[model samples]
Structures are given as structure tokens and as C-alpha cells.
Target: MENIFFPKVVQAVAGENRTVYAYMNDGSIRLVDMKPMIKQGGIFSQLEKDTFFEERLTVLNDTVAWDLTGEHDPTQCIDIDPFTVAECPAVADPLEIVG
Candidate 1:
């Protein structure tokens, strides 16, 4: 989840014409546009599509051993659970928050 900021950043580099809606886990709101993040991959691929259907995401930032499993070092990951997250106030935050 990364506090919705990642999406905003991604959109800025991906789709300049698209609109951004930043929703905090606590229900706070923020708006942004996609005009600065596109060439680096936007909603088409780097977009965060967390909506229940997608789950079990991970964020690996440790450059040394990677994750506890000693596998690939994932920079970021968003566990999707739109329904439950939207419903449960305490479960809307990102799963793996290394930063």
C-alpha cells in the first residue's frame, strides 16, 4: 500500500492525463495527477491493483540477505484486499513496509 503515495508517484511518471486519488489507511484523502511518472512504467504495469483478488505481496529492500527466506530482494509489494481493507480500518495499510 505504501500509503497511496507510491501510486501518485507512479501515475506522475506513467499517465500524465490520468487522475490520482490518494486514500490513507485512516480515510484521509489526497489528489494528484499523472504528469511526472510515465516513462518508468505507470498504471499499465507498475500500478497498484490491490483489490482482494491479489494478495500475498511483499516489499524487499534489504540488499544484503534480501527477505527472511533469503530469496530475491523485493523493493516493494502491495497485498491486495480491497474489500476487507476498505471494510477493516486496521487492515488497509500496506503489507510489507520496509521504508
Candidate 2:
């Protein structure tokens, strides 16, 4: 079976338990739970600190990412898999608009 994928992520917003990623195609949004990954404690350990985690949410081309170097270095970055994010459940009703 082949996997269907969404368009690349253009923006990401961090929240208490999850991060919302907005895709380029049709403005679709996906909510990814990052708590589990952050608890694993490896490269994600930096996110254990609330301020750092909330402040680090960034977009690295097509994925939700973090800039660990405190500089604009892509090499010292970490990001979630685009496919995984696309497959996760939506943060809210897909048809509803808050604005």
C-alpha cells in the first residue's frame, strides 16, 4: 500500500501538550502530540524545560522544528517527520474556522 501525504508545513505553533502545523496545501492543519517524544529524553531533553520548548517551535522548510544552537544553523536542528505529522489527528474540526 502506498502512503498519501499532505503538503509541506509552512507554520507551526506550540502549545501545552501539542503543536499545530499548518500545511501549504489548502491550509490544512495537523496537531501532533509532542509530550511523549519529549519524555523519551534524548535530543528532546532540551524540551523538558517549558520555556525552551514553547519558545523553540519553528518551521524548517516542510517540518516543525527546533533550533538548538541558539543560532540560525540548520545542522543543529531537530524536526518531526512530515509524514507522521500529516497522519496525526487534526487539532480541531477540519471544517471549522475559529476566525
Candidate 3:
């Protein structure tokens, strides 16, 4: 039998230029650029508003999400798959880089 690993996102921080830093349970940080998705519009259109992307960014359903309702309702949030987030390239902590 083979063991399957499912990546779990524990925390998320929105970054400049529509990027998100996803902190995984395995202690790895993944950088996800949301510009492309947001540019496509549709459900992502709401995120285009100023500061909304960053303000609503959160961790929901064990993945990176945007709490559109501001009530932390997982059902009302927009979320990215953990596997997809895990596939993104790793980056050094932004705070550490700036410090």
C-alpha cells in the first residue's frame, strides 16, 4: 500500500501584487500568485476591489480562502485547493527577508 500525503494549510497572509503566502502543516511556506485568477473575473471579480483581497484572505476548509462574508463561514468563502497551493514554489518568510 502506498501512503498519500494531503497538504494542509494552517495559515495564510496576503502579499503585495495579489500574492498569498500559505503556511503548510509541514512547515513549508508556499507562494500563490492570484493575479491570473482574479484577472479572469467571474467569482473572483469581488477580490479586485481595493484592499478586499488582503482583508478577506484567510484559512478555511484547511486551505487558503477569502472570507467574503466576514463571518468566517467556510461555506460562504472562496478557497483554493491545498494540493494546488502546495505545488506553488516555496519562498522565504517575507518578514525575515525584510528584517
TM-score each candidate.
0.24, 0.75, 0.92
| Model 1 spans > 4 angstroms off | 1-16, 39-99
Most accurate candidate by lDDT: 3
List where candidate 2 sits over 4 angstroms from the true fold: 1-6, 21-26, 93-99
1 against 3, candidate with superior TM-score: 3
Per-residue lDDT over 4-35 for candidate 3, one digit per residue giving the tens place of the 0 to 100 score? 99999999998888899999999999999998
lDDT tens per residue, model 1, 1-99: 465522211110111244233353344333333223334453333333332112222222311111223343353332222332233222222333767
Which of 1 and 2 is the better model by TM-score?
A: 2
Count steric clashes of candidate 3.
0
Q: What is the C-alpha RMSD of each candidate to the true structure, in Å?
A: 14.0, 3.7, 1.4
Q: Which pairs clash in model 3?
A: none
Considering only N, C-alpha and C atoms within 3 Å, which residue pairs clash in candidate 2?
none
Off by over 4 Å in 3: 97-99
lDDT (CA) per prediction:
0.28, 0.71, 0.91
TM-score ranking, best first: 3, 2, 1
For model 2, residues 1-99, the per-residue Cα lDDT tens digits are 998756677777775555444454446678777878878989988877777776777877578788787685767788887877777776553445778
lDDT: which is higher, 1 or 2?
2
Candidate 1 — worst ten consecutive residues by lDDT sum? 6-15
TM-score of 3: 0.92
